[model samples]
Target: MSDLGLDDLAAELADFAPAKKKQATYTAREERIIAGFEDIERFYEEHGRLPQHGEDRDIFERLHAVRLDRLRELEDCRTLLAGLDKHALLDRAAVVSMDEDDLDPDDLMAELSGLGEGDDITTLRHVRSAEEKRAAEEVARRDKCHDFEKFEPLFKQVKDDLANGSRITRPFELKAEIRPGAFFIVFGQICYVAEMGEVFTNPQGRTDARLRVIFDNKTESGMLMRSLQRQLNEDDAGRRITDPAPGPLFADKADDGEAETGTIYVLRSKSDHPVVAEHREVMHKIGVTSGSVEARISGAEKSSTYLLAGVEIVATYKVYGVNCQKLESLMHKVFASAQINLSIPDRFGHMVKPREWFLVPLHVVDEAVERIRDRSILDWVYDPNAGRLVEA
Candidate 1:
């Protein structure tokens, strides 16, 4: 089949190249849905659990929890994000099975407040839905981290340190020092302070500095130190990750009224008693200790302070630059409504009353800790019926 022009054709084929492929396009709604789900994934990775819905939960977690619910309901959303569900978050959700037994269109229509018919609904003229409002505050808070590669390894190491207990998280103290190279957990994300700018007097005559903060979700914020302080004080779960040795928060030396004390430990009673068994999910013994918690509770079952029950260490919070006794008293007063009322008899037939036991949920306890950090616990009281800390 060779021809006179075969040599020329072979030369042209040698330089043949295909055109570059164009990037795929996605609708904004689709993109936002994926972005929202990714937050849930990051939450799972950092905390090793799915984001939960509760008034007591962090705002970011609450958003993710709501987003997860919506994703599970929409087949298209699940299909779109199927490839990225490495944690089977969606798969586990299916088993929960949100059953809709009532065949009432009127009830269904009542819940779809912002939904409208036809393409007009897609226009910006529509009011923001309640779900959007819940997440809108933070959805666009940070820009994409273009230089994420430079900080990814640091994130990995911090995560490892947390897993091994080398790094610890405590409530972000009010007016707490925010400097470069510090790690923090804020709004359900790992935030790294990459750089700190020159300190300048703010409008309120308070010292403030601009920060280059990078989030583990591949987002960055050029935020101010005072703004972060205010945010952390307001946020129920905002925490600072302490350094490995001689931590910035817990140093060898502390100034007046800022002494590094002990830790706040939450223990779950393992007692087989009816009262303890009934409220075990929410029952926790809150205490402060300067010594090791393990050593403190070694023979917990033998003591009336522990309700003559073996205890499981549920959580520990490192207290820094604060009076432990005052902190412990503040928490007890905050959760006074949920305080356990019992008169269990000891082995010697002596009636014992456990004062530190609280019927409040763990997350609420966490919120209490946040309030204590900023001394806002003074104005807040635990509402047992509502299961949250409310204005006193």
Candidate 2:
């Protein structure tokens, strides 16, 4: 068989489009086969070699095997390709104007009617049966209820506190206050508190008895209220006052304030702020990873035995176009600037000792290699090399 014929066959198979119905029916395995064939064909053109096969097989058998494998892969690709094509067609169809000749409303209605009223009735019956079964299961589950007696006291306490107009204070010094006849409660955060009035109401014009609020202590001020009705049921009773501290109370503010009419004062906690907490965590993490190297050398004598090992100094495009001699000279200058010592061995051969050495973490060496991997390099000097700089 001619190789050209096989190539043409492969191309034709790849370009072939399946019908919509057939596309939907295509298996995932079939699509994978088509994809494999395409890869194999591209490989054949690039490397001029076929996939590995039994040496004992003749050319015809080898080609047959390859074609069979490619066909399987093509089937898989075709399924996915067909789905993409269908989606593209659908998108195009969405923007296109529907012609009257292409669609008949009456015909569609007649076709739908052909499905039969009995079919709809049967479907409804099945749906109702499922719903009934679910309801029965739910009722049975309710009958097998777990004992909540242990949690009754805690739940009762929360209910009683809300009914008694009590407040709960959070760690951030924010307070949530529950008021009588209130649908929603208010809470203070930072210097301010949020108030909710007439928020929850029943359709019959009755307000909810329970009120709850959750607030963080990191908000603005000016959201407290006073109740005119003291005894709720009693006529002409004494009023109850609830108020937050006035305007921008900073942490540095004093406790003393001028007596204002109908005003109340609330103090903030002396706890560290969020920003301070975050800064402390960051410093802790850094200290755990890299102990303060600069702090260790502070106030040290000049004659102290300080050995700095594993100093990795990497340069990338810095020496790109420059010759080795210039590179060495530049490196020596950098070392001198960094206050690092430099040494070169006599009787130089192909390699030379690095011009400078300083102590650095092993991780730093890995980081430098990763950064300059794409750049031009004459040599990779990891260890100390001693020799006179030679021109590259």
lDDT of 2 at 121: 15
| TM-score, prediction 2 | 0.11
Cα deviation of 172, candidate 2, in Å? 46
Please name the candidate that would achieve the greatest lDDT relative to the true structure. 1
TM-score of each: 0.40, 0.11
Model 2 poorest ten-residue lDDT run: 282-291
> Taking the tens digit of each residue's C-alpha lDDT, what string does model 1 give over 209-306?
99998988788889898867765565445677778752332322456777556788999998999998998998998977655788778767777667
Once superposed on the true structure, which residue ranges of model 2 sit more than 4 Å away at CA? 1-25, 53-392
What C-alpha lDDT does candidate 2 achieve relative to the native structure?
Answer: 0.26
**lDDT (CA) per prediction:** 0.66, 0.26
* Residue ranges of candidate 1 with Cα displaced over 4 Å: 1-33, 39-136, 246-392
Candidate 1's C-alpha lDDT? 0.66
Candidate 1 global TM-score: 0.40
Model 2: lDDT of residue 189: 8
